[model samples]
Target: MAARAKREGVSPGELKGRLLAEGYAQRDHPGIVFRGPWHDRRAALAEGPDVWEVASRLRELDGPEEHRIAVLCEETALHPRHVRIAIDYAAEHLDEVLERIERNEEAAKRSRRAVQRRAALFAAVPDPGGRPRA
Candidate 1:
């Protein structure tokens, strides 16, 4: 953080806070955080929380945005026609939407890993996966 703060002309605390707000987590050491790209496209869509939740879950669907939106609306119990505006908006901002979804998925994976790590530590169980234990 000191190195990054020196490069960015900000204090280390400021850098750490900024990184934490941007979904970064510590790497190598407790205070050392890794910075990565984040796309916050939710504000651009102007949809309700339900719509956002549905849209986030659509990342795993392999198809065009329209098809994904249709499936998402059906699964979320939202009217498909009512969310057409959001779907059209998403189509226009496809790249940003995809980036946002990818970032969300990456964050979820990190969260799962953290939970598993904590559980393993609590249980005193070594990793049982084929890969070498950390």
Candidate 2:
């Protein structure tokens, strides 16, 4: 049905409009068949791009902990004041900091795994005793 509609230069909305114009009505939701690109029909288009501009007031960050906080805060879209407050609040909460660290460790582990895999693949390729393969 969708292909036929498209070949005849029509979209789902156009087909739906024709049904309505012809006085055809469905009481239930008919299973929708996507006739266009999936991303093109996504809800994000209606909501627009998600962009949060965070300007950090703290120019200089002290210590490794403070440096990590500043970098992650800036990258994660948290405003300077909000990030500062959250970091300060989490400072006393050892559990939350540990949790964040655990997440970072997990990410590092994944990255290391990928690197090791690539290295192993490279190592598996034989040098062929320095003879060039034609």
TM-score leader = 1
TM-score, per-candidate, Cα-based: 0.48, 0.34
lDDT of 2 by residue, 18-46 (tens): 55632321112112112224322211111
By lDDT, who's the top model here?
A: 1
Worst 10 residues of 1 by lDDT: 25-34
Name the runs in model 2 displaced over 4 angstroms: 1-78, 126-134
Would you give me the overall lDDT of model 2? Answer: 0.44
What tens digits encode model 1's per-residue C-alpha lDDT throughout 1-134? 69878887778997778666434222211222222322221422223442234456666687987788788777766566645644554455477556667777799999999999997876665456744455
TM-score of 1: 0.48
Candidate 1 wrong stretches, greater than 4 Å: 1-41, 44-47, 50-54, 62-70, 125-134
lDDT of 1 at 38: 29
